[model samples]
Target: EKEKKEKKERKEITPEEIMKPYGVSVDNIDDDEVRVLTKENLYDTLLSLAAPVRQLRLDNSEKEDRESGRRVVIGMVGYPNVGKSSTINVLYGSKKVAVAATPGKTKHFQTLFIGEDIFLCDCPGLVFPSFISTKADMICNGLLPIDQMRDHRPPISLVCQRVSRESLEHVYNIAIPKPAPHLPPDTIPSPDDLLNSYARARGHMSVQGRPDESRAARIILKDFVNGKILSVVPPPILMNGLDAHGLQKLTKDFNLIGTKPAPIEDQDKEKKRKNRLLNQQRGQRQYTDEDEMDRMVRLDSVGHHQGGKRGGKNFVQNKNSNKPWLEMKRAQKAQKRAKKKR
Candidate 1:
């Protein structure tokens, strides 16, 4: 009777109960010590992280006490375009390292100092082979530039998998258009459906009046990396993860765009209206073929193509996509090889 009662009281462990939350945890550092640094308390955070290292440096430099204090080097490491340079600039209070929205901008590591007490070693962003799951994930995380993407489908699909479609609609302020035949009321929008709606809303369409999937994908990926489309991953300990309803609630609570902003005054509204009109006028103005040709000539004269893509992406930027000269050289080599064989 006692054994039966105990057995009945015991709860069975479900598969969903076994998984932990996804996050970084350093064993050496106290939970209190690990913090998300912001622009406001960045210096303090840096100093705190470097405290032990700085102390060791000071102890070693004690013999040379007659000289100036030695600086402790803090190496900044992460995947490309993860904002290493931006963090350093914030710490140094200047544009000490070149910063851009794209990946692989910082080709080389740079050594910089802060107030003779802390030395910042900014390393070029690196992507680990093992950590990479898909190209779309990399692009969505800002490890790859959206413009250089040949295909946007995989990554957009990954986005839908990680985040709910309704959350995307909220972020982009768009609704999926009703199908000719109604889907179940509970049916969710597919990534393609979302992209089509997004493209239409953003006016990203092809010359043929079709929604440009590539352009829409790029825009969606950009918004995602910029934190407009956020995925609410519950910590492993948080109730075995959130369901669709729970996720929807979480998204609504955490989504910045979901919140309503205060009404703008008439003066501010008028200024915005004027700006909108100006932009419309500028966009409406069309250039003739001759004008375009002349503009291209002028741009070439100023060495516009010399630097390649923005943010020092000279290495990865393709200068000649067609590669006519390369193809000709390959053909000549092949001809010579065939003649020799004969």
Candidate 2:
């Protein structure tokens, strides 16, 4: 009865209540509602959002100044490295604004005219203060740059806790040492073990011939940020059989159409096949006029010239198809026969 009551209580707790301790307000979260949009469809989504502004401009077109009324200004502001410049570049269909993985790349406000009447204002990214539980959490969330991090162990430890040792090994192609038998079976591998193994595998050694953990840590953190580790936090409200937006379907499709290249064995087989064909062509004898005449004489000797057929089947000529050389040879043979009769 106690277990059942605890399960009921846990089920009754809302996502907002769960996040309240983390200083995150779910109700105050207001960003783009559309989670996914392809580049081809971005224009349509932007047009839908701009419909109201376009209508307002049309309604006040007569009273407002001609220049001001025709133009539409949209300002983009968000946290650092949250794709503000990338979004503008996508809308413009070219790389107008500079974008980088590190934050604070856009240091000042800039204006760009994407369309005839639409002006996009890109403001510098701002970092807002929040009640963070630990510095590791901030680093894991990519709020701190990995290259500038003084201590990388804490954030790497957080990653080790979230991602399994097998997954890390597969990604980095290095084996991490397992914990001692005296420790609990559930104990995860330490950041030191992963960093040491990864550093050794990548040949990142220090001056003293020790594994360079700092360099390995930067590489691992970059992979984590770029989604190579494949970590994601699903929304609390998400439920099975209730994906109205078909995001789950799209994800499955993307997985089916993987971006990875073919296996090494397959690539090697293709190269070998190409080389074999090239060698075979090089080894074979080349075609010449003498070879063509010898082939025609051999065919006539074999009684293949009767009715322009070979073994009672229509003879197909070479790729040139004109057969003018064969006709000239036949004329010279007829002239030699007439001179012998004279």
Candidate 3:
């Protein structure tokens, strides 16, 4: 009877009771207030969040401070390499602070004035204690630098488990051997197979003429961080109509509608215009045979008047008629000179 009562109590524990230990009240939560942010729509997301963020700050601020016209200071805080500095840089419309792929780049907290009465404070990234299944998860998620990792197997194994062997082969453009027939059909390829294949393809060989697994691991991790390998976790719930409408507005504003190529008509028109202008310029510069003959006569007269002989092999009578032959002779002479020099 005691065990049954305890089990019943455990099963009856409400969300509010579960969150009480974390100082959160389920009744105060507003599901409609949630905003989904993604890298694809970062600027739009930030713009939408700006008003709410400022209002929240003002609401929480003391009345005296609000009356004093104190600047709204927004603190940017998150795990390492999660784009805290990058966000500030984007908001500031310039590189306000240094940003890098490696974690822990921001060593100190820095403040930047973004607008008339707004300031953004960037804090150094620090990992908070949480219930993590494994250290490999942190490394794969880019919380830790892959280069500094002493053991690459665990993280690479995690990556293999998450990303399929086919995806690995396609992304790296290297063939990965299939698991042995004795293994289960759904078995994933080992980290060694991926590392070895990548290393050989990229010519990453160690001092002992073995595949350089460490170098390959770092390269793979960097690719993962840069999103070369697609890994996206979708939201638990689908977007509501209001959220969908907002997304549609954003898409229209950003011109993110169709992937079809731009109309070739415009390009064709531009190309025709360019060709017409080029033809006009060419016609203006083009010299007729009569013009060329007259110019050559003038040059010959000038040469004779200057007391220079004109019957040498370099000179030709009616040069315009024998222009191709003259050019061939010049080219042959150039080839002879090149051979002698060599």
Candidate 4:
């Protein structure tokens, strides 16, 4: 089946065959985009990649490595035609039975090997969103515009040229149907024209009676990126992370290694902070003035100064007398009653 598909692609006309490229390279992009590569391939590509992403997440409890204790999951990620599949294939060699480029090439996820120690996961390309900020979801189908790109955006023609490997004729070759009729000489169509023709041929009409080729081109590129239309899956990984200290590098690279792991006093400070927060939460903790405490002390002094005799009488009979007989007797009797009560 793969052989037949490759043969069919070989025979089909693509847009790259017609256009000429102004020398430039789009090789620096590393985003594994595919969903909204364009509106055309959005639905199919999303459907293709999503099933596998979910499956892998559920596959296992990625326990730490026995030797290095690092949880390792390495997947191939890159733009379409960046030799992603080829690289993976080179890694695994011929052991993994199924590897091929589907229509729009790499639409599905395939699990391959890393010699015998690791797992190599192959996924569909991610379609970067265009136009505006897109929700990371399936329904939008990666349908974003060039305006959403960071730094700069190329013209539509430029994007097509790059995507088709600097050949408009190549793209036209793939787009034109087999056994197509001869059109007039000098009626040679441009890349945009060919795209428009294909868009019209496929019936993508707008309310303004235009072909909407821009939409069509975006769709084509997006689909190819996602492997929704056709692409190749590369081989497996040769040297797993287990060999070159990949696991060691991952495990000990955290900010918490070899530094004596912060003192217990730091924890105590954290506890104090948390307690302060709790008190604040209950509206019970705040600064208090010494003036209130001083006032309370003053009140106790004044109470002592006003004698306990209720009538405001002093123990001494006269103002100057040290003591009076009756007063002394009453005080002693009152003290005795207080002791009895205690």
Candidate 5:
């Protein structure tokens, strides 16, 4: 009876009875710093996973003279006509690079060595999903200058449609309404004839009548010239591929259109700017510091910054799209939950 009663009492133990022995042990599990279930892990778990890897990030050092690494050598890579040359031209404050209304104007890896140590490398515009996947190969011949792309760019297949002799002939028909230069002046048909001919060739048939040639021409031109119909932009890694350093250095000090930066310039510049501002402000406390006086003084003193929109980006900037997309890769690795350093 004693043994049976002892067994029954042990079986009837409550929830608290089983857990109290290991309570402190379970809460503070750490064997040689291999941790488990710490309170810090409960929050910011996703942030720990999503944050960028920073350990091997190259320590960007600045050199003022003609030293080895004074500037950030950035190569603008994107689809043809995505504003590669225009960007380079504006960056160095000169039209050293070519800007045209046609596609594929820049054909060289034109390196403009701007200011001491700062070199602006203007590469040819690359076309994506074309001959290959690497940026170097597409740009090997020259940069493909495409139209200014806002959104989805048109497909090359559509570009093929617009490259026909008939479309050019049609535009000449409606706009000029006369014989084409390529064709004889006397033999050239009326604009309506050319439109009808184009429509018949493309097989545009209306429900009540023959094919609508004018509408067909408009549709073809829309796809070729306008991006509303398609959204294909170029890739950087063309058929040529990236070099070892080009591949490695893309981690921290990297950017392009379609990306954002943390902001640059030294803490000293910030301090000096603030001091100059404070001095100007203190001087202006009295009516003697007239608006015209301050303006004239600044016009002579600093020159440009206090003025309107000087050196600020006036247009939308373009950048590489693949880098951010590649951040979440797993074989790539993850990091320990960042300890909020005291």
Candidate 6:
């Protein structure tokens, strides 16, 4: 009876209770041992990792090889084509490291000297286990090459889902099929629709005059890899900090939308200019000798028909030769003749 009563009194712990000890808000976090360093704040990130300031000492037994009586070795590791070598070059103040756009350019590890006692160890770029949701995410982050990908639909679909549809349409100067008010948001255009739109806009057609979706997919993937599509995925932990709308605003603030493509108004103006030029070219086309000869023959035929005795040949008339206007003129002439006869 006592055990039953105790078991009944025990409360069930929810997920919120479990996460309480780790601190629930982003504001609660203060200090960090490691940070994501970018080109914009490379110096700040390096300074954060520096050793604590110490007073100068007169110790004679210190090693002569250790410059400034201090030494620090920093290991820079990331996936291929992530600007690891470029970061090192920036730190060294010169092109001490070879940077290439291709993956796996640095086959071996390299040690770069940044300061008298500071050294940067550039490890070979290697893929590690990560919480990647799909192949599209990898391609978008430049971890996978677009050409090597067999099916580009999944990545394209993911891009359509995460990226702002308006921004994409504006950037590509194409329309994105919108969902109906009664239907769910899933009614938006699929990967195939987007690919087709791109193919049509760029005139990438197959032998059958159909949009070449495969080629269009390749171009879209290339844009994503080149940062023309600026969508980024935040870590799962930071996700709780904002709602869906807030997250979208944050993405906008980051300028993740690609601005390479021209605006819709500019595209319209350019298209109109091209059409005007085409019309001018068509009007300026000189008549060939055959065309001139055909014109002369037509004029001679009209002149001969004016007074020639045509039986059945004159009966056959063109349907669109101002028939309505000719009938009206004929009625007026008949009215004038009847008045004269009266």
lDDT of 2 by residue, 178-279 (tens): 679898654678989889877766667665456789999988888888877655343444345334333333222222222222112243553464455445
lDDT of each: 0.67, 0.68, 0.65, 0.41, 0.42, 0.65
TM-score for all models, in order of appearance? 0.55, 0.53, 0.50, 0.23, 0.27, 0.51
lDDT of 4 by residue, 1-342 (tens): 966765565443222221113122234323454333443353244345554654555464354423322223457775443445665655545434334433225668877654333456777656555633433221123323322433211333433322322122233322332222576332323456556544654456554445566666656555544533322111123133133233222222221221222212243553464455445434422223334444544454353332235377655233313334435545676899999999
Q: What is residue 173's positional error in candidate 2, in angstroms?
A: 3.1
RMSD in order of candidates: 22.2, 21.1, 21.4, 31.3, 35.4, 17.5
Superior by lDDT: candidate 5 or candidate 6: 6
Q: Is candidate 2 or candidate 5 better by TM-score?
A: 2
Can you write out model 5's per-residue Cα lDDT over 68-87, one digit (the tens) per residue?
54343556677676677876
- Residue 206 local lDDT, model 6: 64
The residue pairs in collision within model 3 are none
The CA lDDT at 242 in model 5 is 40
lDDT by residue for model 1 (1-342), tens: 966775576554332332222232323224564578677688877778877866666677766662444556789899888778998898767888898878888988789888667778989988886898888778877888888999888888878766665566656766664445656544555778888767766666665456678888887888888887776665444446557767555554455443332222244543464455545545544334435545544444453333445676554433343445444545676899999999
Ranking by lDDT: 2, 1, 3, 6, 5, 4
Once superposed on the true structure, which residue ranges of model 2 sit more than 4 Å away at CA?
1-40, 53-70, 131-135, 232-342
Q: How many clashing pairs does model 3 include?
A: 0
Residue 18, candidate 6: C-alpha displacement in angstroms:
36
Model 1 worst lDDT run, 10 consecutive residues: 15-24
Q: What is the lDDT of residue 60 in candidate 5?
A: 42
Clashes of each: 2, 0, 0, 58, 20, 1
| lDDT measured at residue 93 in model 6 versus the true structure, 0 to 100 | 74
Show where candidate 5 strays beyond 4 Å: 1-66, 130-219, 222-224, 227-342
Q: How do these models rank on TM-score, best leading?
A: 1, 2, 6, 3, 5, 4
Range of the 10 consecutive residues with the lowest summed lDDT in candidate 2: 255-264
Q: Is candidate 1 or 6 superior in TM-score?
A: 1
On TM-score, the candidate that comes out on top is: 1
The CA-based lDDT of model 1 is what? 0.67
Model 3 stretches astray by more than 4 angstroms: 1-69, 232-342
Candidate with better lDDT, 1 vs 2: 2
